[model samples]
Target chain A: MKKILILVVVALLSATGYGYYLFQKPSKDIATTKPYLSTIAPQLIAKFGSGQTSSSSELLSKVIQVSGKVTDIEKGKESIIIVLNEGIKCEIILDKNPPFVKGDYLTVKGIFSGFDDMFNEISLTKCYIVL
Target chain B: MKNKLLIMLITITVFGAFAQNKKVTRTGSVQFLSKTPIENIAAQNNQVASILLVNEKQIAFNVLMKSFKFEKALMEEHFNEKYVHSNKFPAAKFKGSIPPSVALDKAHNYEGVEINGQMLFHGVKKPLIIIANIEVKEDLSISFSSSFNLKLEDYDIKVPSLVKDKISEQIKISVATNYK
Candidate 1:
């Protein structure tokens, strides 16, 4: 009877711990997660090139790390966006500003949401600068 | 001969500058508020891609469903996994043209503008017209803001019967962006 009671208490504690973890806030540091890393030039060429259909099965809804030159930096009221190679756009919403500037060579890590057909570019969200 | 070459170069440079006046922004924000007797839910997506064609007075915006962030993790997950089904229809887009009264080349600070466009969301396309306030700064950057009401039923977003009262049928949406 005592062994059974101890087992029940242990199960209860683990369940509570898992419930807390499931409801925890989304992580902001996606770079350290070792996402699918690639260069900005190839990513853009594959997506926006005239002959390409942007049908890459490898990139959809995956965490990606892209490195390129920072072409634009937009500091909006809600977030800071960094455009790499003039096309690969990433926005950091929740995290504080990283130490970077326009023209700096950097790598951004975020989830590759998808290609914006209208704008003809790859979009990444919840992004943070890795280097 | 030198004079002719210089004149030719000047004309080409001037034309090239005018043709490249388009401005774009990716940090645009779209926020929606749902108010019901039981709860008030709001989500904001800051990773909107948009462009303004200065020559044509046309504006286009594209945003991903997964980019919308909610106050609670559970709410965000339910929104993406259950209602919107981000895996199937990943993006929402708007393409519209502004009125002629809002001069693209004018250096005015702010002007009231009308935009008529088709909004594509959840694999459904609907015609939408919006009244917006536009700001054209001296630096050639453009900013605009607009608010509209969206019906969840129109997009086939189903709210479960169990918590029907917790969600609003008509959601209020507000969008603001700055293009540079």
Candidate 2:
């Protein structure tokens, strides 16, 4: 009887612990998570270049990895947005000391935010250089 | 005849520049706050793209649902999957124009100017008018800011009855962007 009671108590404690853990869980860490899809910069740009992409786009909200060449770099207030092949705007956490130029080939990963037709670029946030 | 043609060409070029004076920004910010007695929820997205047609006094904003970052992972996931359905509605957009008399650039500051436009969100289209504040800096950059209350039902965003009190039925949205 004592052993069974102890087992019940142990199960209760674990359940409570798990509940706490779930309650305190932080947001997704993009640096450590695996990307849902991978594509070339130009291909991705071509698919959404029309600027008419709606909810039907398959890559919305998915973390995607892209391989491309650097075409432009913009320094924003908080992040450095590196444009891949002048199409994909990959935002990095470190805004200072931008390490990219006009012709560097690179691989990057981030959440596929959306296509900004006004700016003619696809945006990625929380980007990390995969190297 | 050659001198007259040259004058006509110069006039056309000047008119073209005046009509197409546009300003665009990619690193715009939009933030929303939901408050209730039980809990106050907030999220912000900085990857907003906005364009200002200066001469026409027109503006538009485009924001991706996936870019909104919440404090808690589970709350954000639930917001995207259940509330807004980011998979089905990836973006929320607004396209509107201000009145010609507003004179968006002639003055250094203006407050409470109304802009009427159509807003598309959660696959629902609704007419929206924003009361905004505008500031023209010495460097000729313009700063626009606005805040408004958005009703959940207007966008067809339904919340479960159990979680109703935790989230406000009306969310306060704040938008700010700089065009240089």
Q: What C-alpha lDDT values do all the predictions have?
A: 0.79, 0.84
Give the CAPRI rating of model 2.
medium
Candidate 1 residues A1-131, lDDT tens each?
99999999999999999988776766345656778656665665565432224464356556787788888887888888777886777887645675788889987788777666655667788787777
lDDT of candidate 1 over B77-105, digit per residue (tens): 78877988876787888999988777777
Off by over 4 Å in 2: A1-5, A47-58, A95-97, A117-120, B1-20
TM-scores of all models? Answer: 0.80, 0.85
Task: Report model 1's interface C-alpha RMSD after superposition on the true interface residues.
Answer: 2.7
Poorest stretch of ten by lDDT in candidate 2 chain B: B98-107
lDDT of 2 at A77: 60
Global fold similarity of model 2 (TM-score): 0.85
Clashing pairs in 1: none
* Each prediction's RMSD to truth: 3.9, 3.5
Q: What ranges in model 1 sit over 4 Å off?
A: A1-59, A93-98, A101-103, B1-21, B109-112
